[model samples]
Target: MIISLSPRATLLETIPFPAVTVCNMNGAKKSVAEDIDQNQSNDSDSLFEKHMLRKLCRDNELMSGSKVNASWSKMQNFMVKVSQPCHTMLVACLWRSEEMPCHAMFNPEITDEGMCCSFNKVKRNFIYRNPRQLHGLNYTFPYPSIDWTPESGYPPDAPANANPWRVFGPGKGLGLTIVLDAELFDYYCSSTASVGFKVLLHSPVETPRVSEFAYFITPGDEARVEITPKISTTTPDLVNIPESKRRCVFTSERNLRFYRTYTQRNCELECQSNFTLQECKCVPFYLPKDSSTRICGTADDECVENVKDITEKRLPEDYKNRTGWEKPRNINCSCLPSCVQIFYTKQMSTGKLEDMFNVQKSFLGGKNLSYYKQNMAVVHFFFVENYFTSFEKGEIFGFTDFLSSTGGLLGLFLGFSFMSAAEIAYFVTIKVLFSKLRKNQRKENITQTRIFKSLPFAE
Candidate 1:
């Protein structure tokens, strides 16, 4: 019988057979059909063996092990629950495994400072710190420059030998100091905020006499600040201004007329920890159990604004006792600066792996503690379990610490070996080169002395 195998078979399932033609002694078509049936069975056995080998290799520990591995059918079943921005390659492997926790790999990246992670976006911007009190939006500005030209020949009313300095006093405020047009400054702030981020503005230059600082808050948007030197005149009416014991107003030498200049003071505002963990139970927020934390009511607006206004009035002991000052600050025509921006729109959350996986527990030595503290602002959001400044202490308590003990020991050994070897090699190379050069110089000097003595005797 002549057997003809189809070329459409998969590589793993292909049967080992040669194509053949039946002779006229027997019906050629019937013989070919029998051979084709035999080859089909052979192909099935090859495919089954290949499938088993693949499964075994993928599951072997320390061979081809991963977090996710399973039979083909099991993997397909797990795919129904996959719905995040995490790596598809990981998901593809994970679908085969049914035992994996959804959040097994969702932990944050731990830096010296804290946990850093990229956000859930098609193109993710990595956040090194937790989103906290100091929120900011990214902004860009053109590189600034100033071009100066003197008027050719003085005007008819010019004082002879007059310098430009004579026209305006340095104290009079109009020399050649650079001041941002208020419109451009405010527009920058507003534009940054429009992209769903909080923004703070500080005057680029000091203007000494600013009574009411005028800057465009956004394009075509304007904001004014009023400054008063008198302590009793009332601190700038802004919401949630932290109270300070000193009432002295900071003064600078910039010569410009402004009623007030906005200064972006950096500070931390924290959510007070409640004795017990309750759902969204945060300071400056009311939680009555029935109302969702997200469902903040109209009364919340009044309370929040009051907290801001009252906090600014560093109420003296006497003022604190007074019933009248304790009452919420009245909001009228005066608009209070917003402490936080609120958006009512829903946004699709992008999913990403938390960055703190290996480093937090493993990476150590050097001034890592201080380095972490400096950059703590970047990744403080995820390791919110413990507020300790030290990661070593935090690790002991298991506050978002995910690194293995072995990784830490290995890292320390490698770090010490690298530094020690570098130092020893550097010293040895320097010593050997110096010694060889000194020996060569001594031989040359002796030869030159002998040659000079012989020349004199011959003369």
Candidate 2:
């Protein structure tokens, strides 16, 4: 008997082996049929051992692929839940005790905290994939910009540059007082299952991520934050080095596609968006991406997470199990941090609020403190000082400063300025001319006197 293995061997539990023929051991009356059958069976077992293990691996891959496809399937379930709108999240916002329009001061933004309002954010050109499809979208919010940049200073048209900082709206005192509502009823679906808000203080150039870092402000407690500027300026010499060697991008090198500035956070956001789009065919709304790109919804959560896991290289299981040496490929962004990084250090103090009787009547809003206490949190965002000393060497020591400093040093060490040296030259020239005139006059007088005395004059 002879066995021949077919090409398609994965579906069957057993595969036929290659043809095998038994030869006689003693060359006299050897067994033909039963002996050949036994040899073929042995060969089939060997083939199963060699290829069955690989077939099992292929099965696992197919199963994993099915999961990925299922996650990518169309599901209409993920309608954006705008349970917390701007008016809902922000109960009241005050600039130095005067209640200002919250909608005017803040623009409705999307963060991991879900439907957040951002204040003092730089204006960016953004578009939603499905703007009209989103219900409860705030159409009245205004887009704002400081008209500021690292390369160029603040707007020059504004009168008086005394402050040298952006702390004007609330004057020299506390900046803005904000009351947040952490609706406790919505906690069932949240991962944290807590009553609070995640307060993140970051630059206007960056898109804040709740996954990366945040400070939690619990409900019913007032948090007072005194912000001090933490700034580091880069010298102009660093610009000469290549970006690969220096590992930091400068203001002049704003190479980012979506943002006007190139920050490390922004670069990472774009990198993540592209990578996620490559893996999952979509990107999250918070990421800065092209308008044409598809936005991810609730159904794509698994694929997004898998892509994140792949980028993070959190595949130690395969290594530990020694399971065929398969590992996730990490996403390489090759993004470097910005050379000029502006940060703020905040000193915060918290205190519990008094109950309904002691609480102010304005905050009560005809509703008792029982309703307010379960949902409200107040934050005092203030500047620690009126002015900050930022030693931006890029703007300092220009051609004019260099000339002025050189001349000042010459006057200081050598005791002479350009004007003083010019004055000395003028005086010396005038004195020399006067002395020559006097010599000529004396020579003429002497010659006349000698001639008069030697000749027939009356002496």
Candidate 3:
């Protein structure tokens, strides 16, 4: 008769971390490690090993530069829980609207003092000195010529009488003295008025793209510029606003009418100048209060309302039916499909640098920054049970299997040799026990026969 024997061995299988507890993504929870017995029951190990492994795992968090995996397990009667790692990040606007045109020259000097007339001497005298001084001083007379002044060609009287000009005094440098001398100004009373100015408008549009500019004219320093929308009639050149800087121009004109200085306020929202020639202010693009058109759907709407809506809506019913339906499933991928890219901790990668800048630009971005910062620490968990099972059950496979199996050849040889030695010891022990049993049986038989012969006489 032949006896068939079943060998006893251990096999391991890959299992996801069992459900232990539900951990809120926003909930603050401390990390913990657990040990299990051969039957997968909780067992305690020395504090040193657990502490060391945890420290090692933590130090190798992905954000910390190393990509090592950690471990987790489900509690028998409780819930298996883990922190959800934040993935979405933002890249902020690095460029700003630069050099917004402010004050400009409207009537740049053309044909010096054409309005001077012969009688303008009194006005020129007034322009050169105070009227009180002219009347008070003793007279020294050689009345200057009225017709075509040597240099200006117009009579000197023209400059004095001209509403825009005044005697500012010698050494102080002569200039047209008026309250309305903004870089660009319009006059309703004068004919043949020369109006030249450099107009610059602040834009939120990004660089490397062409955009249009709108011009508005207003009377005072109001927050809003009440502009009369004209087509090409009031259009300025479409200048290239460089990255992080504003556009500039040196413009001059001798004729302008029916226009007011394009005015703006220096307040918080409307500080960005609308028109005229002035130094440009480097303001950020798509500010919270900005009304300018933006490329990312109304420059103000960073998330594109559709994307915002998706994030705001509750999980769909169909999704809820899935194992992880209560929330969005965590799907981590990398440039390489075969590589298991695990998120180890909340960390900021180079990718997040741009996002930080974008968030700083707006109130919403500011609020979100805090959230991203808190969630940057994450940990990835991996189970080694499958590896151990594969090794024990001789089911090694995959790219790792080839190397592991090759490296484990020595262990396999040693294990087999140990088993063979044990078998030989067992066989020798069994033979000795069997031989002793036969010898005892023979001695018992002889004693029984001797007793039977001694009792024969009585029979």
By TM-score, who's the top model here? 2
The parts of candidate 2 lying over 4 Å away from their true place are: 1-80, 126-146, 159-165, 169-172, 297-302, 310-330, 356-358, 389-459
Question: Which prediction has more favorable lDDT, 2 or 3?
Answer: 2
**Most accurate candidate by lDDT:** 2
Tens-place lDDT per residue, model 1, 1-459, is 111211221221011110010000111122222343244443533333323223222323332321222232332221212111122111111111122321232222111111111111110011112222211222121222111111021244544212211111111121111101111111111212231111111111111111112111221111122211100112222112222222222222111111122121111111111211121222222111111123222223333333443333333343355443453232221122122111111111122223344433212212243433321111001111111111010012121233344445555866545456577787899778988999999999999999988874453
Q: Count the backbone clashes (under 3 Å) in each candidate.
A: 33, 0, 40
Task: Please report the TM-score between candidate 3 and the true structure.
Answer: 0.14
- Cα deviation at 456, candidate 1, in Å, is 99
Compared to the true structure, candidate 2 yields what TM-score?
Answer: 0.59
True lDDT of residue 113, candidate 3: 13
Output the lDDT of residue 80, model 3. 17
Point out the higher-scoring one by TM-score: 2 or 3. Answer: 2
- Cα displacement (angstroms), candidate 3, residue 324, comes to 34
- Candidate 2 residue lDDT tens string, 1-459: 111212211111011110011110111111221232234444533333222222222333423322121111111111122225566667777765677777776666555444456665554432222333332224343433344544444555633321122444323243677777666654323324344766767765466665456667887888887766545456676576567755668856765655667667777777777778876688765565554566664346566766665454544353334433344364567677677666666778998866834866555545668877766777788765545545332334445678888889989998879888788887899878989999999999999988888876465
